[model samples]
Target: MIIDFHSHIFPPPLIAARDKYLSDPCFRLLYSSHKARLAAADDLISEMDASGVNKAVIQNIGWASHDLCVRTNDYLLEAAARFPARLIPFIAVQPLAGTKALGEIERCAAAGARGVGELRPDVQGFGLGDDRVIKPFVETVAGNNLVLLLHADEPAGYAYPGKGAVTPGVLYPFIAANPDLKLALAHWGGGLPFYALMPEVGAALKNTWFDSAATPYLYRPEVYERAADLVGENRILFGSDWPLLGQRRCLDELKALNLSTQTLNAILGGNAAALLGLE
Candidate 1:
């Protein structure tokens, strides 16, 4: 019943050439040689089994080049197909690519993609909230009821290496603008519960949800409890952000929290199953 709602896996060729092709200094710094060494599907499965995670929603790192998004989605689809019971694949779409991006999403969903993203606007160099770019993509996903997972970057209080400057301020507008899209934000929506606490914004955004990915590096365990208080338990989902942050550490941190059994179950897997229609 344990599901990691947010996890990453890359093809071996990408891992082999990660150093040579990755030009973004932030991305390069975040991806150590050690990280690249463990990007295989088999390695990820072993890690999941060790952590007692029954299933993981595998997301692609869209922070690289746009071209790589399509390739990575293909690789992720293949990986999920190889291990359907263990892995659920989420596709990545670059809005800047126009019809081609829309086409990619259609093709992948037909091939069994359950969701879309870990979409990074700062790294991907586009505005997700922009109606012109995101409208069709949103319509397509909404039409199909596919979940849209976004890599929400916020001001982390302290300046961290390899972190993007995009903040919750930027992401909130997008969420507000697109109310119909079923969205999940990574890094607990990059501290979005704080903003959602405000009356004006929270009332306006009900379709949004947060994922607990990379929580160990970012916040204390009580933050999850506080988030549940602010956003409600149904709005939260478990995400390990695997490879970047291991599954064991994230789950360990979650276990330390004094959450209700129902809340814990929802955050761990129930919400994800419901969001992706795995139920």
Candidate 2:
């Protein structure tokens, strides 16, 4: 089964919120209206069918205002309810909101949210490894057996558009500290696989995983092969970061990589299925 693990879908409420926020001069410069044009559940299924994708794990945008997280999550849950076979919902919670954020996580999980994140600390205005606030939230997700997907930032030298604020240095500490938590770092773990050979930093983060969201724009097409060689095929998964990067483009990028059938299959779907317990 082909599963794209990192994609975004904005419902109507989120669309309105996005419009309101984007109207402001400060916000308008950073994001484009293209983000607001996400496919709904039915549209997503149609696109997935055309692309030969069996399922997609969807997330909400990080730029959403405080109340919008819950509203968008509710919309995502409702969409998943209508098409559970095609969509896997991941709830977005803003850690800076403290207890309120935890409550949202609980509520969303209770309503069947399979995971929490695509958490953008830069856009969300928090540190990726802010232990005191995020620890409790992490524990809740770990306890519930849900995956934690963080939108990791690339190193300073490698920073590109849509990189957000999740630097590799910041993520190293976070992953090191939260050894037991299952983490899928979006955007090829912020170019982390390239640094995995470092004994001091690499050994402490065995549970870290990577999703190839926005990789086509950031790295060469051969990156998947190099990443699999460095991080092991089991730790990598396919992610389109769709609507921003189209599903067809991402799949074509993956196909262009000269990898073995086993590695290709793992990156395409096997790794995500195993990580999300879909097996």
Q: Report every candidate's CA lDDT.
A: 0.81, 0.80
Q: 42 in model 1: Cα distance from truth in Å? A: 0.9
Q: Write the per-residue lDDT of candidate 2 for residues 166-189, one digit (tens) a residue.
A: 778778888888899988888888
Range of the 10 consecutive residues with the lowest summed lDDT in candidate 1: 29-38
Regions of candidate 1 where Cα sits further than 4 Å from its true position:
24-29, 32-38, 63-66
Q: Considering summed lDDT, which 10 consecutive residues are worst modelled in model 2?
A: 23-32
Best by TM-score: 1
Model 1, residue 270: what's the lDDT?
89
Model 2 alpha-carbon drift over 4 Å, by segment? 23-30, 33-36, 156-161
Model 1: per-residue Cα lDDT over 1-279, one tens digit each: 899988888889877777764575335646754534347788889999999999999887665455767878889999999999999988887777888888888889999998988777777777766788878878988777788888776675666544675578887888888888898888887788887779978875698889988777788788889988898898998888788788888888888788889999998888888877776
Candidate 2: C-alpha RMSD to true structure equals: 2.4
